[model samples]
Target: MRATVIHAPGDIRVEDAPEPKIVNPTDAIIRTVATCVCGSDLWPYRGLEPVGDPHPMGHEYVGIVEEVGSEVSNVKPGQFVVGSFATSDNTCANCRKGWQSSCLNREFMSTCQAEYVRIPNAHGTLVATDEHPSDELVPSLLAVSDVMGTGWYAALAAEVKPGSTAVVVGDGAVGLCGVIAAKELGAERIIAMSRHESRQKLALEFGATDIVSERGEDGIARIKDLTGGIGADSVLECVGTSQSMSQALHSARPGGNVGFVGVPHEVAVDGQELFFSQVGLRGGPAPVRRYLPDLIDRVLSGHINPGKVFDLTLPLEQVAEGYKAMDERRAIKTLLTP
Candidate 1:
């Protein structure tokens, strides 16, 4: 099988690698049908995160089940499935509380940008569709596996409510999906903070009522001005940078909330500032398994089309170019077909 390997920062290559096998009784191997480059993958690609020895890349995937271990009974061979980046047993205490991402037996997927992937905790992590979906729904189904799910979690964490004002502090794929989530959750006013024309347009199409193209203190001020000087009722901090985090914190009114989903990079909160601001904060890896069933249904029903975030598509063999396009901001997200 061919897989994406990062030999070093700014270096991505597609090379032959051994196919994965069931290392545990709960494991299942799936022949990847669709996968994509995630914003998080850029961390190591841009040298923001260290890339030690070369290793396979990617985590978001939708595939056809090729085989399952003896203990796996939730799915069978030949079924189409979508799974989260964080695999969980789903039977654990955390999972029972709706936090599958923090399950006792959890494994983070890191080799999905290939022809085949071994899914851990198959019984609890993989959600199979009733039947094989049409080719047109594949991209949206693949989006439900990660980006859309993460965006939903961001909205939930921020406590987006009916007729409330919500702010999204990023223009990436996840943030765009956050706008969709906020709209579906009944946010009457959705403010998307973006500087890119393409992203701003997409955000509007996804239900953004306003766009704030400023940054730093200016962005927060714009959010306040739009919210009648009280700031928004909820803020989704989709970017993990310190500046973005601060913007999210300041963009929310007192007693409001901020849901931060970005993998925090050099981000920290000032204790005094947070205490005085009285804003609630919650974030981490999304429990995508908990929302997979509904998100998949939404895709199949044509209720939400988060797949539109993928502005570029490439064959799995051209994975390097996918990474380059996303890194250069030429594409919001890249869809990779195997």
Candidate 2:
């Protein structure tokens, strides 16, 4: 099997790798049908996140189950399934509470950008569709694995409500998906902060009612101006930078809420600013498993096209180009077919 290995920042290669097999009764091995590069992957690729050793790269995946372990009964071979970025045992207390990302037996699903990958907690992490999905539905279903799910979490954490003015910071795939999420949540007005023409257009299509191309304080003022100086009722911070974080905090109305979903890098918030701002903050890795069922239904029903975020697609062998396209801002997200 061939898989992507990150040797160092800006150094990635596709090379022969060992095949994966079920090592535990709770595990399953799946042949990759589709996978993609994530925004978070760039953290290690850009050298911002430490990478002391070469390792497998990628997490988001959708594939057909080739085999399951002795204990995996809910999902069997030949079923098409979507998986969360993290694994979890469904029986855990946190899993019961809808935080499968923080399950007691949780494990990160790395080494999936390959021809074959092993899945732990198979029954808990994999969501099989009602039937095999068509080729057209693969991309959308794949989105459920991470970006779409994370965007939905951002909206949920921000407390978006009917008739609420919601502001989204960032124009990446997740931010655009946030626009879709805010719309689905019944937000009356969706403001997307984006300067890129392509992303701004997608934001509008995803239900954004306004676009703010400013940054920092200027962006905050624009959000306030759009909301009649009271700021938005809810703000979704999709970029984990310090500037974007501050923008999200300041874009919310006093007593409003801000949900940040970006993989934070060098982010430090001022205690005084948060204290006086009176804005609630909540976010972490998205519990994608909790929302997978509903999101899968939406995609299967053709009610949403969140997969449009993938402006580029490549063969699994060209995974390096997929990463470059996303890092260079040439593509919003890149999808890979094995």
Candidate 3:
């Protein structure tokens, strides 16, 4: 099978690779139908994160079950399924507490930008649709696998409440989905911080009531000005940069919360500042498995179209261009079909 491999920073290639097999009884092998380039993937691509030896890339995927291990029962061959970037055994203590992303038996997916993928903890991680969805719903279903799920977790972590003011600090795919999540969760006023015209338009279409194009202290001031000098009730930190994190932390009102979902890169928080600000912070990998069933339903029901975040689509073999487009900010996200 063909898969994406990163030989080094600024170097992405599609090469032939061995197909994955079930290494554990709880594993299942699926033929990937749709996958995509995630914002996190750019970390190593841009040299922000080290790329040691060459390895397969990608994680977000929606696929058709090709085979199942003996222990796998929830999904079987011929079924369409969506799984999280972080696979979990869902039966673990953390999973029982709704934190599947931190399950005792967890595996992070890293080779999904291929024709096939081996799913760990299949019974607990893969959510099967009732029937095969139409072609049009595939992109949205694929989005539910990661970006949308992450965005939803961001909103939940920030404690977005009905009629409350919410701020999203990012314009990427996940941040755009965060806007959708905030709206669905009843945030009456959604402020999306973006400088890109396309992303700002999408954010508005996704239910952003205001747009703040400023950065640094100016952005925080704009948030405060819009919130009547109190800041927002909740802030979603979708970009993992030091500046974005600080913006999110300062954009929230005292006693409010900031849900940070971006994979932190050189980000540090001042404990003294946090203490004085009295803002809550909660974040990490999203428990996408916990929200998969509902998100899948929402996609099928046409309630949300997070798939719109994918402004570019390419064949699986053109994966390198997908990475390039996203890295250059020419595309918000790239959809890859195998």
Candidate 4:
């Protein structure tokens, strides 16, 4: 099998690697049908996030089960499934509380950008569809595995409500999906901060009622101006940078909330600023498994199409190009087919 390996920052290659197999009775092996690059992955690619050693890359995936361990009874061979980037035993305490991303037995699903990959805790980590999904539904279903789920978590954490103004910071795939989630959650006003025309257009299509192209304090002022100086009721911070995080915090009203889902880099928050702002803050890795079922249903029913985030699609062998396209911001997200 061939998989993506990042030897170092700016060093990525798709090369031959050992195939995966059932190592645990709770595991299952799946042949990947589709996978994609994530913004978080860029942390290592850019040297901001260290790679201790050359290892497998990619976490988001959707594929057909080829085999399952003896303990995995809920899913079977030949079933199409979507899974979270983090594998978890659904029976854990955290999982029971709908925080599967922090499950007691959690593990990162790495090196999935290959022909086949092993899924741990298959029964709890993987969600099987009612039936095999068609090719047209694959991309959207694929988004449920990570980006869309994270976006949904942002909306939920921010407590978006009917008739409330929800501001989304960042226009990446997850941010755009946040717009979709906010709309579906009944937010009357959706403001997306994006300078890119392509992303702004998609944000509107996903239910954004306004677009703010400013940055930093100016962006915060724009959000305040739009909300009559009260700021928005909810703000979704999709970019983990210090600038974006501050903007998100300032964009919300004193009693409002900000949900940050971006993979934090060199970011530090000021205690005094947060204390004075009086805005609630909450966000971490999304408990994708908790939201997978509903998101899957939405995709299966064709009620939403979050998969439109993938502006570039390429063969798995061309995973290098996929990364390049995203790294250069030439594509919002890149989908890979194996």
Tell me the tens digit of each residue's lDDT in model 4 across 1-338: 88999999888899999999899999999999999999988889888888988999989999999999999998899999999998989998999999999999999888788889999988899999979999999999999899999999999999999999999999999999999999999999999999999999999999999999998888888998999899999999999998889889989999999999997777898999999999999989999999998999999999999999999999998888888889999999999998
Measured against the true structure, the TM-scores of the candidates, in listed sequence, are: 0.99, 0.99, 0.99, 0.98
Q: Rate the local accuracy (lDDT) of all candidates.
A: 0.96, 0.93, 0.96, 0.93
Report model 2's TM-score to 2 decimal places.
0.99
Residue-by-residue lDDT tens digits, candidate 1, 1-338: 99999999989999999999999999999999999999999999999899999999999999999999999999999999999999999999999999999999999999999999999999999999999999889989999999999999999999999999999999999999999999999999999999999999999999999999999989988999999898999999998999899999999999999999998999879999999999999999999999999999999999999999999999999999999999999999999998
Q: Arrange candidates by lDDT, descending.
A: 1, 3, 4, 2
Predicted candidate 3 versus true structure: per-residue lDDT over 135-200, tens digit per residue: 889999999999999999999999999999999999999999999999999999999999999999
TM-score of 1: 0.99
For model 2, the stretches where C-alpha displacement exceeds 4 angstroms are: none
Question: Positional deviation of 312 in candidate 3, in angstroms?
Answer: 0.5
Model 4 bad stretches (over 4 Å): none
Candidate 3 Cα outliers beyond 4 Å, as residue runs: none
Cα lDDT tens digits for candidate 2, 1-338: 99999999999899999899889999999999999999989999998999889999999899999999999998989999999998988789999999999999999988888989999999899999989999998999998899999999999999999999999999999999999999999999999999999999999999999999999888888888899998999999999998889889999999999999997788998899899999999989999999999999999999988999999999999999999999999999999988
The stretch of ten residues in a row with the least summed lDDT in candidate 3 is: 135-144
Number of backbone collisions per candidate: 0, 0, 0, 0
